[model samples]
Target: MIKKPPFVVLSKISDQIARLETEVAVASPTLANVYNDLQCQIDVVVANLEPLQTISGHIEIVERSMETILDFLSSSGDKSISAANVYSLLEPLHAKIHQQGEQLRKIV
Candidate 1:
């Protein structure tokens, strides 16, 4: 049996560790850089969620207003309310309410 000098064994082990680090870095490069990239991605996600938050707030208002509209439409027989009255009331709310509704549906 033969015993190699301590430095030779230590040098081989050190080289192997360096090679492992280099191979791993081929994808991510470094731990700090990878962490920074993750933080950046999270920032983007949070920024994107801002509009959803706004819509959630707006949806509350729409839901309340819609309950009123639904009540008005639901009340009485067919001939009781005039179509003209409903049209005039709904005309201004048409575009925004529809667009907001589509966005709201996507969230739900």
Candidate 2:
């Protein structure tokens, strides 16, 4: 089986995160606290990854993060979603992505 390039995977993950952000914004404007920081972090990761020519080394981390985010979104349609809850759910992933970006910077 052929694999996609890292940039394509990152782009798709970025798109998914953006879509989720928009849905959260519209569905729960009051939960801006939940998604605003996440959006910012994601923006930073995308920006860092966008110009890279050597992200293949970090694709696994990126893909795992994408899966975590997708799973959270899928199982969170209930009204139990709170600012703190979402924040906690996404914080580890955000940190991981942020760290990955830093690593990429050092490598480039």
Candidate 3:
């Protein structure tokens, strides 16, 4: 049998997940559980697309970012981090960084 492209398989899985999520919404108290499970399953599948070294590098960056964020928050004294700071400033900066990283990766 001819093998389908990975995107085809992933698209089918995505459709199935959409259906499952709808079912979960109808039967469960909240959708967060379904979303978390779907995210984990997708992560497992996507891990196969990258080398272990690359995956570990990305993971290290995320780990370091979490540590740095926590450290800053802890040492900020009376200064505070607000949702506005995150949503208005940090998140957009993060998105730009990720977009640039993805563009550069595509060039390689």
**Highest lDDT: which candidate?**
2
Supply the TM-score for candidate 2: 0.39
Over the stretch 24-73, how does candidate 2's per-residue lDDT look in tens digits?
88778767556667667767776766656545546577778778877988
Compose the digit string of candidate 1's lDDT tens values, residues 41-70: 555555556567677677677777777887
Candidate 1: global Cα-lDDT?
0.65
**Residue 70: error of model 1 in Å?**
1.5
Say which candidate scores most in TM-score: 1
- Candidate 3 residues 26-99, lDDT tens each? 67847847665885677566555444346446656766776777687779878867877657545744765585
Rate residue 34 of model 1 by lDDT: 55
Model 2 segments more than 4 A misplaced: 1-59
* 1 against 2, candidate with superior TM-score: 1
Name the 10 consecutive residues with the lowest summed lDDT in model 3.
47-56
- Candidate 1, residue 63: Cα displacement in angstroms equals 2.3
TM-score list, all predictions: 0.55, 0.39, 0.34
Each prediction's Cα lDDT score?
0.65, 0.71, 0.64
